[model samples]
Target: MPGSITGTIVDPTGAAVAGARVRISHGDQSAEQEALSGDDGQYSLPNVTPGPFQLTITLVGFTTQASSGILRSGENYTVPQIAMPLATAVTEVRVVPSRVEVAEDQIKAQEKQRVLGVVPNFYVSYDHHAVPLAPKQKFELAWKTTVDPVSFGVTGAIAGIQQAQNDFSGYGQGAQGYGKRFGASYANFVASTYIGGAILPSLLKQDPRYFYKGAGSKRSRVLYAIANSVICKGDNGHWQANYSSILGSLAAGGISNLYYPAKNRDGAELTFENTLIGISESAAVNLLQEFFIRKLTRNIPNYEPVSP
Candidate 1:
């Protein structure tokens, strides 16, 4: 006499698992039959000369389940609904190497962060889900900023301001001084930017770009930006002490004192003092960033996970 066994396969979520491979074997007289669960997760195997039997089910991304049971000949049987545990996804994801490709995709997305449809706001990542940039990526972004035409234009404006203030008297007044100041100013910008934003950041294993936290209460946003100037995202995509900014600012200040007039020079003590001032100044700027910059600017991408 022949009997039949019927069962269903489902996940812990109780979702029907179609295409799951179900195997049934009974001693040397084992009969193997496969049933793909329907959308309803129902699988049925019929016409078995039942005796001592074992049932197993396997699915990709799922653990295998095995059951041993006895069946009486000529008796219809229903196995209790089978529940297959989910195979862990972590190990499978770890084996894949799409990291660089993922970063490149993110960088491409970041390159579009602009302001008012005109100004280059490339350094801002609207993505709260950003990945750590590779060293080469850091340099690439720095090179992009350094060579940007807007960067040169902005540097020219700073040079004009320095000449207006007679900031570098050592170079003397007029066109020569203006040109000298321009070179120095541009160099300063480039050095500080590349060193702090790219070179040193890559070396120190930091992330140079500002991670936009465009949410929370007003006070929280203010505090967040201020805290960020002294603490920054690491290359591992974590927030850490911003040694790169503090040291970069100090280095730039000391180097600037070399070219300024002796009378105008900030001494070693003054340099250190200036570095402190720089940090404070950054806080002020960060405050403005938290409170004002977004409004003054436009065309900012809306990839920020939430709104402030």
Candidate 2:
């Protein structure tokens, strides 16, 4: 086929369909062509052989249509203009998205999707470029997680485990002892999450959520998730040192000294050690995020569709 078929395609409203798939077939064999319609509804399928053929047009969310005609050999055929009729009016209405508003709404929705249908999973945003939370919103999320009923229940469970394991033996074994351990565990979760995941992140204008980099080699994804612990996305949409995470871990550890048994409490050296431990914990969590959490999480939202 040394020649081509050239033509224009349009909808009833005369709007060019940019992504329309055009397929041509002749004889028992077939040939295919795809051309993006120009702004003015003009499209050209260069090097199409001169022959009798059929043009098949298709687009997503649209019905398929076809036209047949004969072409003279070596002819630059300008087929009759093809106008696609509206197949159906979909009742599904789509809203044009505003990026900032969409991110905010997504965050608000996530604040409600809890683990165990109770513990707030507010901090885990699926969006990589989520909008920065306002100061009040940050505290509100912290307060919500701190006071969640499941949080208290889980603290009791940990306290039970700790009692069985004699983890903080200085606290001793009794209802009173269990209460102390429970309080300490809950306090740790609250302090670390609020300081590292919320307050300092808000203050430093860093996103606390781990950005999922799903498209890459396994090694790259592993390194990306691990690197996220030390580097974070800033409000300026750039990567920088994760001051919020580092300082927050240290602050949470330092705050533990106020409640933990002195024997269990870290002196400044222990505080730094615990801070390192927290950073390591964050990397482990991010690794789980990269490979596991998305599967467990339900009702994952769709990304806003980018219209061409």
Which one wins on lDDT? Answer: 1
1-308 per-residue lDDT for model 2 (tens digits): 45677777788887776667777878665566666666666667777667778888877756788888877767777878888876686688889866556566767777676554545566676665566665566676778777878778888999999999998788999998999999999988888878977889887888776666765677887898889889988877888999988998888888888988878777899889878887798899888877777666655565431211
> Model 2: what TM-score?
0.62
How much does each candidate deviate from the true structure in C-alpha RMSD? 12.2, 14.2
Residue pairs clashing, model 2: 3-48, 4-48
How many pairs collide in each candidate, listed in order? 1, 2
Candidate closest to the true structure, highest TM-score: 1
Cα deviation of 78, candidate 1, in Å: 45
Regions more than 4 Å wrong, model 2: 1-103, 114-120, 304-308
Q: On residues 152-173, what C-alpha lDDT tens digit does candidate 1 reach at each position?
A: 8888999898888877678788
C-alpha lDDT of all candidate models, in order: 0.78, 0.77
The C-alpha TM-scores of every prediction are 0.64, 0.62
